[model samples]
Target: MDKKNLKDESILNHDDYKDQHGAVVPPLYQNSLFTFDSWDSIDQAFDHKTEAFIYSRILNPTVKVAEDKIAALCRGEKAKLCASGIAAITSAILHCVRAGDHIVTIKNIYGPTNKFINSYLKTKFNISSTFVDGRDVAEFENAIQENTTLIYLESPASLTMELQDLKAIAQLAQSRNIKTVIDNTWASPIFQKPLTMGIDIEVHSASKYLGGHSDVVAGVIISNKEILDSILMAEHELLGAKMAPFEGWLILRSLRTLPIRMRALMDNTMAVAKFLENDERVGKVNYPGLESFEQYDLGQNQMTGYGCLLSFELLTKDIEKIKQFVDSLQLFSLGVSWGGHDSLVYAPIISYLKELSPEQFDAMGINASLIRISVGLEHTDDLVADLHQALSRIA
Candidate 1:
C-alpha cells in the first residue's frame, strides 16, 4: 500500500495480515522468546545479519505491527512502542541529552513529564532545563544556551490549552542545530503531523486517543530510522519498557476505529466548548476550536482539528462552589486522563490545591476554579444538558 497517498482512515486499515492464514486482523505473538532454528541462525540474529525476533524485550511481531501502523500514521520512518507515555518520553529525552546538556521546554507541560525534566534528570544526570511560556517563539529563543541540545514542546499545553508555533519553533531549533520533540497526544496523528512540520521526534501517550478506550496504557515514539534505532538500541532496551503483546493488540484494535472516534469527539467537544463559551457561569473556555481563543489562528495553521480535551474557568473561584458544580454533574464523570468512551471532568483545584502552592499554580496557569473536560462519544445534546444543569447548581 502507498501510505503517502492513503487517507487517514485508509492508512489504519492497510496493515499486512497475509501471514495469519488470511486473517483480517494480525494475530498476537504472545511468546516471550522466539526459538532459533540453529546456532548459525542465532549467531546471524545477534550479528544483525538476519531479521529475527529473539526476545520480547527487544522486539515482537505483535508490537512491530502496531509500531508500523503508528509510524505510517505519523508519516515517520520508524516507531517504538514503550510501556507507558513517560517511558516513551524519558527514552526519547535520554537519547538526545548527555551529562551537562540543557533543554528548553514549556511551563504548562504534562505534570509527570515536567517532574521528570525538573527533578529526575537534574538530580541523576546533571542535566538542566529552562521552563518558558511557549506561546511566543521569542521565549524559546531567549532560553537557548550554549549547552542546549533539545527543545521540547506540548502544543495546546496541558491545563490552559496554550499552543506553540510548531513550524516557527522547528525552524528556530533547526537553525541552532538543536533537536525538537513534541508530545502529540492531544492531536494524535489524525489531527496533526508534527514530523512533517520539521519536528525531529514525535511522541504519543497511546493510553489516550490512539487507544480510544481506557483499557490500555501504552506510548509510542516516532521518528526517522536513525534516531529511532539509536533510542531503541540504547535507552529503550536498557530501560526494558517495551509494550506487552496484549497491549499492542489492543492499540491495533483501537486504530481501526480512531478516525471515526476522533471525528465524533471533535464534533461533541466543539458543541460543549461553544456552550461553555456562551454561558455566563464560565469565565473563559480554553479550546482551540473557539474563534475567541488567542491562538486559534496558530492552531489552525498547524492542526487539522481541535481535539476533545478542553478546560474552562468558572466565574467564581470559591472552592466549595467548584466542588458543588463538579459533584452535581451527572453525565460527565470526575476523573483524570482523557480520550476515552466516557466524558470526564477534572478540577485542578480539587486535586492540586494542597499539593501545589499558590505561586506554582499561577505559574502553570491553572486557576483555582478551572475545570477540564474530556469530551467522549456521548451524544452532544446530553453533554450540553449535563453542563447546563451543573452550571445552574453553581448559580
Candidate 2:
C-alpha cells in the first residue's frame, strides 16, 4: 500500500488492486443492490454514515473504480461516471446551470450536444445559451452576460478542430465569475488536462478512446472536490446517472491499453493527414498535429501530443463522389464513432454539426467536401493504400 512504489502505474490500472478472490483482474460486482446485516446498518448507510452500496443506481464499487481512475488522470479531486457521453455532458451542465441561468457555448460542437443545449435544455429547464465561434476569445467575452452561469467549450472544436486558448478563456470566465466546463472528448486527459489550465469541470465520452474498443458506451466528469462533491450530492445521488458495473469494469480494462492504443492511432493519423495534405483532390486538411495548421503552436502549448482525430475536404462537393470514396475504402470502416482498433470514416457534410451551412462552413474553414477520418492501429501502408484507392475513384 506504499504510494511511492505502486508498480509505477496509474492508480486506475487494475494491476494496482487484486480482486477479493485474489484474481489479477477485479471481479465485476454485478449485483444491483447490496444487503445489510441489520436495520441499524441499513439506516447508517442510508444516512451516508458509512461507505456501503445501497442501490446500483446511486453507487457501485465497479463504477467507483472507473470514476476514481478518471479523476486521478485529470488531476481532479473527484470524478463520476455516467451511462453515455451525452449523459456526462448533460449531468455536468445541469448540475451547475439551473432554471433561468444562461450558458455560452462554442458553435461547432457535437450535434447532439448542440441539440441538447439549444432545444432540449431550453424547453425543459428554461435555460438559454449563446453559441459562438469558440476560437474567438473576444466572442466568448462578449457573450458573457450578468446571468451567464456556464461557459462550455469543446477544444479542437468538433469538425473544424479549432483550438481555443484555454488559459485566456478560463481567465475570462474567472473574471466574470462564471463556471467553465469543457468537453475533453477530442483531446483525452493524456493530451489535455483542462483542470490544470484552470477550468472548473471536464467531461469525456469515455466511449471513444477511453474504451478504445468501441464495445462499451461510457462517460466521465472530473472536477475539483468542491464541484465534484456538489455533483455527487445532486447529480450522483438524486438524479442517479451512474454507470453500470460491467461497463465500469470494461472501462478499467480499456484504460490499461489506452496509452499504447492512442500512440499507434495518433502516429498513423499524422501520417494519414500528411498523405491527404499532398493529394490534389483534397481541398484542405484539419489536424492539429500538422505544422501547417493555423493553431499548431497553440495546440502544442495546450496538449501533450496531437490526437488521432483528423478531417479533410475534397475538391468536389458531390455527395455521390463522397459516397464513392467511402465505399472504396477497404481498411477503414464506414462507422459513426472513432478511437477503436479499427479505423473509421464519415462525411462531415452528413455527420458533423447539423446546423452548419455552406456559408457557415466557409467562415469556419470547413468545406462541403470534408471527410472526418479517425485513424486506428492498422498498418500505415494499408491505410494509405485505402486512401489512395478511395481518392483515385473520386478523381
Candidate 3:
C-alpha cells in the first residue's frame, strides 16, 4: 500500500455505530449456530422474521454487518456474500435463468465466467448463451431470442477493456422484459454502480479490490431484495456458497478505505500505462483512463474513475521476447488475480489468438504480445521504472 493509505488506515474506525460495547471493531460471530430463548422465538428465527441468528450457513451477525455496509456503499437495496466470485456469478445467473433459457453476454468476460455459463450451465440446464461485441447496442438487441431471459454484460469488457453503453443496453433490456447482470469487478462500486444506471444485478469479486490485500477470496451480489432472496434460494442455499464470518470480517476491514486505495492505485496505473504507451515497442494499451482508448469517452460517462487493471501489446510476436519481458519484471509478481496491494502479471494472451485470421484477431482487440497488468500501491516511479527496465530487455 502507499504511504498515505498506510497512515490513514487507523485514523478512522468504521465499527463505532455498529458496535454495542464500544469495541471499535465489529465482533466476529464465530459460532456456527445461535440459541433461542423460547419456542415462539425459535420459530420466528427459522422464518427469518427475527434478528436472531439460526445458523452461520444461513445468517450471522458479522456477515450481516458486512453485507449491510456493502449494500449501503454500492447503493443497492440488498446484497449477498458468497464463497468466491464464481459462486456469486453462477448463483446470480441461475437466479435469472431456467431450463431451456437463453442469455446474451459480452464476448470478453473473465475466463471462468465464460466457461461456467457456456459449458457448465449449457450442459446441465439446457441453457444457451451468445457472446457478442458489447460496444454495439444493436448487437445485444439483435441477439435476443424468444427464450432470452437475461442480457449479461461486462463493461470495459474484462480483457479488452471495451466499454458498453450501460444505460442504452439497460433501456433495451427493460423494454424487452429481460433483466441485466454485470460483473462489476473491474471498475468496482467505488468507480461504478450498474444498478443506479438501470442494470438489474451487479456482482463483484470481493477477492479483488474489495479485499484489497489478496488474502481473502470472496464475492458479492448487490440488487433489490426480491432478486437477492431468489438467488438466496436458487443459488446460495442449494449451492452452499455462503460467505463465512471471518471472510466477511476480512472484506469489511478492507472496505473502510477502498476509495483511497483505489485512487492511489489509479495513479500508479495511469503512470504505467502512459509510460508503456510512449515506448516504441508498445503496440496498444487497453486502459479506459487513457485518452487514446477507443471507449474513453463512454467510460468517463459511466464511471467516476478508471480502475487499475490494464492490458497492453508489444510490437512483436516472438515468444522468447515475451518471456524476457515478463521474467525481467522486478516488482510485479506473476499471478492470476488483481486489485490487491501487490502488483501482478499474467500470461501474454496473444499466444491463444493463433487460430484467428488477421482481421478476426484484430476484431477481438488483442494480440500475441499482449500483457495484462494490475497496478498496485507502489510508488509511480518505481512501477514505471520496473516496466521500462523489462521492456528494454525485450528491445
Which candidate wins on lDDT?
1
Residue pairs whose backbone atoms clash in candidate 3:
350-367, 350-368
Report residue 106 deviation for candidate 3 (angstroms): 0.9
What is the RMSD of candidate 2?
2.4
**Per-residue alpha-carbon lDDT of candidate 1 for residues 304-327, written as tens digits (9 for 90 to 100):** 997899999999987789899999
Compare the candidates by TM-score and give the number of the best one.
1
Cα-based TM-score, every candidate: 0.97, 0.93, 0.93
- The TM-score that candidate 1 achieves is 0.97
Please provide, for model 2 over 1-395, each residue's C-alpha lDDT reduced to its tens digit, 9 standing for 90 to 100.
Answer: 56533331456464566665788777799989999999999988978722458888777888787777777778887888888888889888987798989999988888889899999989998999999977779999898888999999999875779888999999999988899999988888878989999999999988899899989988888998778777777776777777889999999888887766777788899899999998887877999999999889999999988678888878888878888998899988887887778899988667444666667767865677788888888899999999999899989
2 versus 3: better TM-score goes to: 2
Error of 3 at 293 (Å): 0.6
Q: Can you rank all candidates by lDDT, best first?
A: 1, 3, 2
- Model 3 over residues 161-276: C-alpha lDDT tens digits? 98999999999999999999999999988789899899999999999999999999999999998888778756787788999899998988888888898899888898899998
Q: Please list the Cα RMSD from the true structure of every candidate, rounded to 1 decimal place.
A: 1.4, 2.4, 4.5
Write down the lDDT of every candidate, Cα atoms only. Answer: 0.90, 0.84, 0.85
Q: Give me the displacement of residue 333 in model 1, in angstroms.
A: 0.8
